[model samples]
Target chain A: MTGPRETLVGITDVVKHFAGGGNVLKREKRKVHAVNGVTLAIRQGESFCLVGESGCGKSTLARTVIGLNAPTAGTITYRGQRIDDLTPKAMAPYRRRMQMVFQNPYASLNPRMTVQTILEEPIRFHFPRLSRAEVKAKVEEVMLSVGNDPHWGSRYPHEFSGGQRQRISIARALMVDPEFVVADEPISALDVSIQAQVLNVMMDARDQRDLTYLFITHDLSVVEHFGSRVGVMYLGTVCELAETKALFANPRHPYTQILLAAIPRLDASGFRHTRLAGEVPTAMDLPSGCVFHPRCPHANARCKAEIPALKDQPDGTAIACHGIEEGRI
Target chain B: MALLDVSNLNVEFPTRHGTLHALRDVSFTLDKGERLGIVGESGAGKSLAAFAIINLLSKPGRISGGTITFEGQDLTAMDTDALRSIRGNRISMIFQDPMMTLNPVLTIGTQMVETLQAHRRISHAEAKRIAIAKLREVTIPSPEERFDSYPHELSGGMRQRVVIAIALLTDPSIIIADEPTTALDVTIQAEIMALMLDLCETHDVGLILITHDLGVVSEVTQRVNVMYAGRVIETGSTRDIIDAPKHPYTRGLIAALPQQNEAAQRLNQIPGSMPSLDGIPPGCAFNPRCPHVGERCRREIPALRALGEQQVACHSAEEVAALAGNGGSAS
Candidate 1:
């Protein structure tokens, strides 16, 4: 199963921390590490997924990748070039190479604007020299590329349903023809009957355009279905990374195993179930050593004190757990 | 004994054009300790079916015609006075969004105490004590501390837990959960569902869960009913509905799901969107979108045809049944 290096995007120990608010006169300053020591890579045209509960740094990592939030530490390299080193003004040219599709369609789209303006605005920013007629034509082309009817360009956001509006958002994201896209929970906000339709359209767009995706979601089942590579995040750190099949079939980390087991299998419903007893610990005060030790069923004294590094397993899967490192499980 | 029995229920809504028929001839019985899952796409009348049973349909929505018998009593004939007595005391409901069941301004403890006081005569201190115990029953951590917290302070998952705690406080004989976990992530969805199943079994309560998610239905429910535009197109045991669905619409939906283990260049999806309930197609509401639709299906609406323990409502039941058994792609 040896494949090409094919690394399109590389994240090297990225750390994004948000400063906490307090009295400046006589108070201590705290930092909430939204994403800590996160490192993963997406292949040229692979669907890389991140799965975890809320507040697990999944969205933080996605935001950091698309430049919505800058990394407080670490580096991000794109196509063998350092992206984190670029200034915001100098990063404008590189922005066309990467784009992001957000989760909420209502908040993402401006209610006052038509679909035409939403799609054209991106192209206007990237290629400002294009004439008015050319911009109109390009808007139609991009809209059609994402399966939105070109006629829909005139429709306002209020006229369309959730799925249709999301398509418009996709059109806006793909207008620049970016090689890499981060779709953050794109299908999560739609009705079940329409979720697959949106997923199919996005898959088609990805293949047609050779777009690499960083799909972030909390549902492991969707990751198993769509992601070529999967990473399990917990408490601001990546705990496991492997091919989708490898992660689901033979999950090495205890947190990932429980996450997978909790997704009720279609055939083995009710028969095989492990309801995690305790709630996810507060992310503000993370557990020491292994962040997942408090929830890990296989946790030991070693796991409680030492932060497990993401090391490659003999089977090629990357797991961050002391139990697996010590051959305890 | 059957805890809830809804017979030949029909609900209609007043609209600009005409009366919009929602649920039709929907008859379902739940024993004292039974788990039934009503599943269908949006606007498929699953939610209305639940609402009609408990007389919860408000305003433009009304149970125009129906006989709702709960615990051997006729609920349809009861006035607001009688209905209010049974609404939260004997039967409770949990909605998809936790905010629907909770008040934003009130503390969790106040809301719980108020709900308890609505049915039972108790002191405020006693009500607070019972509320704290109920919160603990739903597995809420630090109930003593959380009782003072507002709904906005809790996370989405925690808020849902509070909703469940309120729903279970009265120990209702029947609990109708309408897409309770749809707003949750899959991992949390499973945990909440497992908790509900245990609670039901422990309290000997009959459960009616309404959802558009088939995966959740097939997991948590014992029996399943597949609804179309506004009709129960198929009804049977959960095993029969998942392993051997009868109606064309049901089969199409099952096939449309992108299974985890299946390999395909493209995901299988139902070709067209759900037909608007404003005015459904000619005979079969699904005839326009149905792949196996025929002359009989387009001309005559079918009744529930019996097939062993399962019942199907389609003109081409035999053909659909045979196709379901043969395991051919439907959509």
Candidate 2:
């Protein structure tokens, strides 16, 4: 536990673009730039949170990292080995080491499958040599770890409440004992009380199993509580990356500042929020230089013409804004 | 007289098995130009209370008992023609989804003009002028150009701005917004809430905000009513409720927030989930999850009783408030 932590997943300049908006007669096609030129590293046993608006492509990047959607470019390395381009058979081992949890538990878990069957299917597919009794023992252990009753394994997903179903979803992800887990908005669909329960379950699983996470969510409050490090995404680009405390205390990028200022805290009132001028531009028709330049208040002529690259600050935070580099912000 | 008063409001849906009580004995009053927030979980009947105020409950769901008094008139007893004038003119509604509220085919300007002309005897040109001015009031950029654009042409935030403009078009005395910004991003939601607050204050319009987000409720509303199961368990000033809640359920709700906890610490999660409407527990609906539950809680339902500056429907409100002196929890 005291060893030097190493980078578990190294993502370099990843890009994902989808072909969208074609016509039957006019034959017009446009590229929806979902995740573009995002570079980040997930260290061992750290919960790296990616936060942004709905269309900011944070989910797209998470899906791309897990190989659910193939990246249009760039490389994803797992423990100094390139695994993004591996074939199905070759990628099977890496898949066992990495698992994903989706946003909606209602849709993620199969209604027809019992808890035992759902937990056992992954083990059977990954390691066919394991006996039924061994698989059952593993399922019971994981179920109990997540606070679900092992005796209720015969019940279906619908029998459990939403919070219990989400716990089951976490248990399913841990079935493979993956070293890394990518949970995309795991608690967004839950109530406030239930959200805490699910988040606690995830935190406990991380501590007990020594797991690393790439948690994606739009909620800044949850990120403040759960994230070790945070990356703020705007139009598929990482605008700011820092420790959660640093990000919340002193957000450097203009977009990050606006995003943080908009969160309605319980301690403050009177409807005060920093006003951003315009709405987020569509990804299909992104701005020329910086994707956020159209809405950024600190944007200048250079910002409109040249894209800003992520520059490291002396305090270890990375910001992608010309204004920050020029001391204008 | 109060601008709007709801007393002993009960809404129910008659199902084949039995009648499902969606809301029970909910009572609150909204003064002129005042903002009241109705906060609870999803199935706590916050939206149903709002829907019942305007006689807009969907099929089979009706107001079983209560009085919705608007300007000294009982809205529940009013005829369709009398209520029609009050629905969008005296009091208007802003739904959660802007796309659902705005007609997809109709342009923004047309919807605004139609809404204005429905109640007032105004010409098309005068109505168009008022529509554009209302749009400008909401700070929609280039109101003239946006008026001509269809609902699909604008972004989500812009569409909500247009919805707010329409709600304000008739110069209504009160606006009932039910989770109006829940579909938008946080940044957009903040802007919208601020804009609504500004308009409500400047125009002297009462607001009844229904949402599940406690932070937004605390920031935008002066008073809040905490609903659980079907009843309003706690009602008090927003500051009082946020600073020191009386009800155990309300305390648990405030403590459950991620912001209330230390960084990376486990949140103060309530033990059980909210019961379904069909299978509501007897006595206090929150007795199963209440930390201060007693034998009396399971035997009889608690009614709203005055407790210094607030009204709470919990038998152990005094003990709970004393135990958790501040911050609602051990955190």
Candidate 3:
């Protein structure tokens, strides 16, 4: 195992933008700024979470980091080396070190392929030099590591339950022995009972493999429970970053506070649904100054004109809200 | 009067191997203007219970036994032809997938108008006008513009709001919303819950909300029913279910959820898989996974015993609650 001090992934000022069009021939470009200027780091064995609403660029950032979609600007360096500029030939090695587990296990795996074939395909591609017997042994070990019975490999993805397919997906990710894994909403598409089982299995595997995770999800409860530190994003910007305790206990940002209040909580009497205003704003046409200013209950005139950059606080956390910065609330 | 009374309702789907009992001896009473939250894990038959009330279960799935009385009308015995008139005009429903309740090619206006026309003999123009007003009643953003948009054109939240608007078109006496906001984000979910709660109060409609979310049920429902493996394992006021859950399954679910408190070392996830439909254990369905299982629990399926306003079906309910630190005597 590598030293715990190793920097598994370093993402610096990563930006991703997609251009759609009204006029195909006239070349009208309507750019949707998905992940604009995101930067964070993941140590060798820490769990990091990127949390936001459905359209707030969490998934885009995950894809950008895993090299699925190339970023529009900035650098993605794994273990202190840049690979965005490299050709496909040079990028092949990086692919083996980083694998992604998608949200929908039903669609993520090949519908026709057996779980055994899915696991073996990665092992075959990443370790072409290994003999057939060695590849089969490695695949079985990977399956066992993910808490799936080795015999389950013969079953198709449909034959297994949602939780089991997720295990298969995780097994496929581990078959390559990736140092950094991007788990994108892995538990969202599961039953609550099944969700618990899958989460436990993932945690156990993370421990044994010493894997670095870029855990992307919309569920703040899971994020607080599992993430070592978290970055709360809104409108393609990191609004807040802090240790799990500091963030949940004394959230510095107004958006972060709103999100926390919005989640349903159970007390003796019943569920307390925090009454926040309106729906999430369309990212294409966000507010002029602060992305969260329109929704922030503590917004002022100053928030409407000047954008707040992430500023340090006495507590070891970073927040980018004018209200937090000026102590307005 | 209790606006809705369900007694010994059992739903079954005829599979090749055997008849799968999706619901078993389910019983509950919902008074007028009351919100009854049904909470359970997936496949716990929470949604199936809701569907059964509407007589909307698919082919091969039929009501095996019992009755549902709405304002003294035998809902279980009413044929589909007789049911259709009262179904939308009096009792409406919303689904977890908002799209399932909506037609894709039809504009929001066309759909609402058709629903209005089916029950009330109104002119086409009058129907359109009422549809617009109903749309506004549900607080859809720019209802006029949204009335023209198809289901596909609107966002998930908007579609759900429109679905609620359709449900409220006739001022239904009862509304069964099956996980309405389970698809939406937190902010939007809160908005939807508040909207539904307000509408239910204004109309004095009995609302039977089917959901697995403890938080969702607790926020709006006056009463809560905890289901497990196709049985209503526990029933009480929301306070009792949340603060003084008696059944081990209820306690297990509460413990499993991640609380907001930052001091948690780990979530207490309930172990063992939910027994498959065909593999339900004979005694307590939750016996294998329940932390407080005893000898009697594995031998006999306990009947729901009366305890104040709450009802629980567990042989060791008292002992389990005490051990689980409920800090109160089981009634």
Q: State the lDDT of candidate 1 residue by residue for A1-329, as single tens digits.
A: 13755798889999988987445786768678789899888789888999998889999999888788889999888887888878988889778989888898988999999888888988999999999999888888877776678988788998887878888898888888899989999988876657777888888887788788999998776787788889999989999999888887888788887787777555655624666656677666778999988877788898899999999887878989888888898
Per-model DockQ: 0.44, 0.84, 0.45
Model 3 lDDT per residue over B24-115, tens place: 99999999899999988778999888779879899899999999988889998888888998887888999888888799989999999999
- Residue B141, model 3: Cα distance from true site in angstroms: 4.0
For each candidate, C-alpha RMSD in Å? 2.7, 1.4, 3.1
lDDT of 1 by residue, B48-70 (tens): 89888778888888888869898
Docking class of 1: acceptable
Question: On a 0 to 100 scale, what is the lDDT of residue B172 in model 3?
Answer: 91
lDDT of the structure predicted as candidate 1 = 0.84
All models: lDDT?
0.84, 0.92, 0.84
Better of 1 and 2 by lDDT: 2
State the weakest 10-residue window (summed lDDT) of model 1 chain A: A264-273
Candidate closest to the true structure, highest lDDT: 2
Candidate 3 deviant stretches above 4 angstroms:
A1-7, A21-27, A131-137, A268-278, A300-302, B260-264, B294-299, B307-309, B326-331
Worst 10 residues of 2 chain B by lDDT: B322-331
Query: How would the candidate models be sorted by DockQ, starting from the highest?
Result: 2, 3, 1
- Residue-level lDDT of model 3, residues A1-329, one tens digit each, is 24346677888889888886346888877678788787787788888888988899999999988888999999999889997767888989999999999899999999999888998998888799999899889988988876678987778998877888898998899888888889999999887767767777777777878788889999888887788879999989999988887898898788888788777777522334455556677766667788888877888898999878877778879888888777777
* Candidate 2 CAPRI classification by DockQ: high
